[model samples]
Target: MNDATTSPADSALATRGAALDLLFNVLAKRVPFDDAWDASRPLRALEPRDRAFVRMLVATTLRRLGQIDAAIQGSLNKQGQQLKAVVQDILRLGAAQLLFLGTPAHAAVDTAVELAVARKQHPYKGLINAVLRRLDRERASILAEQDAGRLNTPDWLWLSWRKTYGTALTRAIVETHLGEAPLDITVKANAAAWAERLEATVLPTGSLRRAAGGQVTELSGFDEGGWWVQDAAAAIPARLFGDLAGRDAIDLCAAPGGKTAQLAAAGAQVIAVDRSEKRLVRLSENMARLGLGARVTTVAADATEWRPDAVVDAVLLDAPCSATGTIRRHPDVARLKSEEDVEKLGRIQSRLLYRAVDMLKPGGTLVYCTCSLQAEEGESQITNLLYRRPEMQVVPVTADEVGGLSELLTPDGYVRCTPGHLAEIGGMDGFFAARLRRVG
Candidate 1:
């Protein structure tokens, strides 16, 4: 009998199970799982449940990587850093299911053993089974005594948070990321109409937050081009433009077009520019879906090397940074980012801001934003730019612009949102945004 004629459900299970394994492999190599999601081909055909399972596996493993490794080490007699990558990934996945997820002990061990056999790593399956069984027996004491910070995060990151936000706030921030993030949607035109149509709760900033799991494209009004998925915090910088109807706007580094969609929806003639041809494909698709293609023009060029045909009325530079702010949504961020990487990203952010200011028309707004929690990337970057460019004036965002988030706004009128700030209401991502005007 030909294996190709197998039942569809069996084939799907095999594919999804393999994708989960691949996801774990990529994550064990320290590559970010979400960014890897865009690159991995195995996950493309997975059902939503399996996809969610794979995501949960990668996220829980990364969130508790330190603790998971500790648990593995504690259970092993001969712990070596040079273990085979496949073996390591299998052990981590099994441990994650056994300890973090409520997966039954037998299912976790048996499935992991089957996976190991399929991958030709059977000699170590016994090792995997023994370790996981021990984890089950010691679950209560192991979890009770685990240091929250050390178990959940790297020592340097936990220490940095402690120094920056104090112990209580830092603990809250970590706890917030431990939970899943809600899906926030930005409506195209009428918020009330879309909210009613989709049965989603309308947030104060006009974004919609769904409970947790659902088919996004199948949601009501998605096919009608009613709205797009965007975090409430991510929508703020574009809204700072207020009324941009018929105005020319430039969105720098605008691939995958969340901010570009916001600008085009506001009636701005937007030129969305980014360096990557691959990412621009997704941006083009998003614009087509929303029927905003006419208002937005896609350009493939580096912001540093490309110049606009003419200065625009406004420019929004969503500069790249360490992206620590979005850890709740993309938990892989904490595992992949290092302190040295932040310093390098800060330099790039400074360069992007310098080029953005030069490309702005006089009296035009320049909104600078980043999904980073560090002061070096937010306040200090803006402060340094202010000294270098005397012609630019800090255009403070008003209470009306932030829509009841005025307290989160800095005294200088910049918006500074942290994970700890919105902890009670499902927690918001950390983002910093500042609007400036070119006066000369």
Candidate 2:
């Protein structure tokens, strides 16, 4: 993808080349898009605008992959014989442009054909050209034929949502995932002032919401480290602990620390622990950026086996799961994760839940949360926790605590914020959180 290219056309072509390669890895190898992009030399070499384009191209291809494939397959002449995965990927990139991104037919098609040649997929050049042209010419009809809400989402996710949330709510959730999530920030101080200064909406829970896209680091307060990007929904679990002034709190599984930052900012003496040393370093750096380094300590240890020297006042285990709740922000989740992944993550979540409660002082709070829509990862964890640990009892998240938003709470009073919640104000991540007390 990198070459001695100066002309605008050549640069754009090279950008598409990078995108094609990135898309191939994500689709063919099941590599996470962010990881693939981080590891891509050509993408890094491109100018910022080109880099953005490449990212958009691949993300859009993955996001609308089902629809994109439909357009390509419907255009194919042969019924049974299918294009190679790489060839289908090229057409997907082109179709994503023509069908969704508003990329001009000539530019999208020509560059995709070039990408075919670059990827040594030149044999299917005419096929790529033909499929893309037909998609462009019949974009409206092809679009009309698509059930994007149903088609784009994986069967496992769709069925799970339907079974859990029911067909109507599931529709709302999947349709919402089709779009990109907006930016939400938790300001270190003066949320109203930051909201006004940033021209962002102050969400009821105090996280500032802004339509502002592009580089978050370029934003005004970012350099000053006044705020950190955290979804309004993702901000909930951290707030459940209330004022942690002088209290010792542990953010079990904290990395790229958002909740850990919240705990520290709330005047808690926070220990942010994660198994990955490299991730802990990143979290420490981000903490420094926010000027909360003094209040926080970083620990690189497997939380399952690691325990605090003494039981602390609070423990927040945002146990990792399928992450199906944050699909709007990370579209790759729908493709990257499977049912088996959820089952495996459930086992880990259970282990982490037990470890988290063990690290909590008696009568102290332990908040267990996950960014997953799956029942096994959310509700079931709490049920099992109560059954296994006779010392523990559900504290039941109250509506008053979450900005008087009762809908954010489930019937059993655990916090269950889904994509359908706050739909009028651009929905939040699908997050489930429960606060428990060690009654023993």
Candidate 3:
């Protein structure tokens, strides 16, 4: 409710307060941060630089909420016990700027106090000023002492990863999410050429990796559809069906059409099926932009209920799961998702995988994958399906097929790409995929 003032100082303070409004929208109201940001009237009215700052403020706070809260509580000593909610929000925002974002200490403190006054919590101005000043002085020591990986991660997710991946590797996954995710693009063709043109580094899997910061639309190959943004791990499932030229491949649960585009680009007659018509619109538009719309038949229907008139040669079942693996890109996954949701999603994934299997032709390949760290959603589902379907059997993914990223392959021949796998080359999303064939 802060009024914007003409002075630069008041404007900066108002923008920071607006960032807090976004944070409250997410943490208090349970709104997804992206949705909140998109609908933010205040943010939309800002200049480009201020808009970017608002985004950074909110994202950095969410990404480091645990750390910021810990730092604030530590600074408050016993006085923190009865702090007002608005006061807490202001302090958290201030600490994020000072400890993590490297904002000038005086500016951070000044703006935070100003934010408190504007929020009508004028009584807490001195408390906000004192706590933030103290935090700035002890920021280094506080940071060193705290386990930010544990702090930033939700308790449930942290425990799940620790139980699933063990202590050290789970720590690595948590640590990875703290940093910004890099941008990786799947080119239409000539991966090397596109990489050179975009000034990016080509990953072993052939996806191009560029620096983490930028406007994706401004990139060289975006408008021409020469390439599309696809994570290195995500780009793998479609590639599993190597040389799809002339093959009829169905991408079940396909939306936003990255894999569909890849299948079409590979010369496959692609039928992209998804339940959400809204997302299919996006997929259709993306296909049009890439000039691959002709090959892609967009089907807006549920994969479990929609049957192809005839069995297809290959199927890519990117079944929806908890999406825990994509935490690096969507920090909301850690905040918004829960254990019960994972259980529910696991069931849905099972149903979809079953349907995808039924649509596969005799000797056709079915590549089942999920961007999930839980075995119940990934490996366990595959095990259950194989036990139930006598005709279905595992078709091992090869290191040669996946650009010699052999480290991602499991003993049973599934590809399990994790954030820990390619540490030196940024990292890939955590994904579990099994290639299957109908032997009967």
Candidate 4:
């Protein structure tokens, strides 16, 4: 092939190489991949298009990690040994492009070989070329008979899901996670009006749905502060507070505040409390863009350690949890989390909920919420809190409060959404929320 035609693919592979090197380095140092991506100074230095390409490769590879690893193994040396993790990442990226992304075989192999040579790993380039060429030859047979679950998830995680959710639900959940998440936005006012302005579709819950990709700031009405990005289900807990006009509301652990904005927009005087100043910086920026900054009181302090000046009319504690519920939108969640981590977060969540109740006014509303699908972090934690705080009575949410989320309510009126709940019309991120009122 001529130099011009060959250069683009070579450049794309180099970008992939840099991204994988960065990913493996961070992962080896025990950094969470999402945090690593956010903290990557090198990745940030690249052009926006190059950054997008690298992010796409990394994200897609991780989403189909199990399959990518399998493909690499199947294309390995006769010794049955795999390449080093760094080289393996390169091969996986190449495999992902060729098999899944439909990039031409010549481009994928040629560029991957070029990348290997550039890295001074020249000897391995022939191996990469041979295996990838073999993969191209056997693409149909390899893909057709492949078991999706075995090829898409780590064995332990797969086994855990099988035992926890049973066969059918686990399969469906895993399959749902494979697709790109839809972009759902919450508007300050009418969803229909904002949808028309943004040229997006309005969902049943009044969230504006747009197909994925694009710079969020470039979208129309973004500069005008017309709406904010929020999962449809995530918008429920704030709404369940129900007409907070002229009320005093405390949003605990409220950094990078979506629910806080929801409250502020509904006319509540909001105290947004969070421990991290860095996170609160983003929250403050969002508030400014949305024009809700004037309504919010930003407090950088731990929720458990810091006491409010006085009791508020309402409290919304969107406690930190395993965050497994957001996996579809953030597939890196799976790579970073473990079951033991979930237990630790559940303990912390329980503590925060108890502290939030102590800060609520007598007979005032307190909404406890988590973006977690695990029962231990959601229902179990809430159930334990109820037993300890008898004066706190469940103030069941009415159908009207949730808009179209009536079907997601528990028998006692708590809100729960899962991968299984809304799979057809663009599934929702899982969440658990309960409304309680202090009786004494």
The top-ranked prediction according to TM-score is 2
lDDT of 4: 0.81
Worst 10 residues of 3 by lDDT: 1-10
Give per-model TM-scores: 0.91, 0.97, 0.95, 0.93
Give candidate 3's error at residue 59 in angstroms: 1.2
Residue pairs clashing, model 4: 67-151
lDDT of 3 by residue, 229-250 (tens): 9999999988888888899999
Error of 4 at 127 (Å): 2.2
Error of 4 at 283 (Å): 1.1
The residue-by-residue lDDT of candidate 4 on 1-440, one tens digit each, is: 12344556655765766677656754466576667777777675466777887777777777777777777787776656857666777788788887788878988788888887777788788888998998888888887877755567655556766775678876866777777788899999987888888888887777788888899999988899879999988988998777899999999999889999999999999999999999999999999999999999999998988899999889999998877778787777777778888889988888898899988899899999888777787778879989999989898877777665577788887888776567887788878899999988
User: Model 4 off-target regions past 4 Å?
Assistant: 1-10, 77-80, 155-166
- TM-score of predicted model 4? 0.93
lDDT of 2: 0.88
- Candidate 3 clashing pairs, residues 3+ apart or interchain: none
User: Tens-digit lDDT track for model 2 on 209-316?
Assistant: 998487889887787889999999999999999889999999999999999999998999999999999999999999999999999998899989997899999999
Cα TM-score of candidate 3: 0.95
Whole-model lDDT, candidate 3?
A: 0.87
**C-alpha displacement of 203 in model 2, angstroms?**
0.8
Best candidate (score: lDDT): 2
Per-model CA lDDT versus the true structure = 0.82, 0.88, 0.87, 0.81
lDDT of 1: 0.82
Q: In every candidate, how many clashes are there?
A: 0, 0, 0, 1
Instruction: Determine which window of 10 residues in candidate 1 has minimal summed lDDT.
Output: 8-17
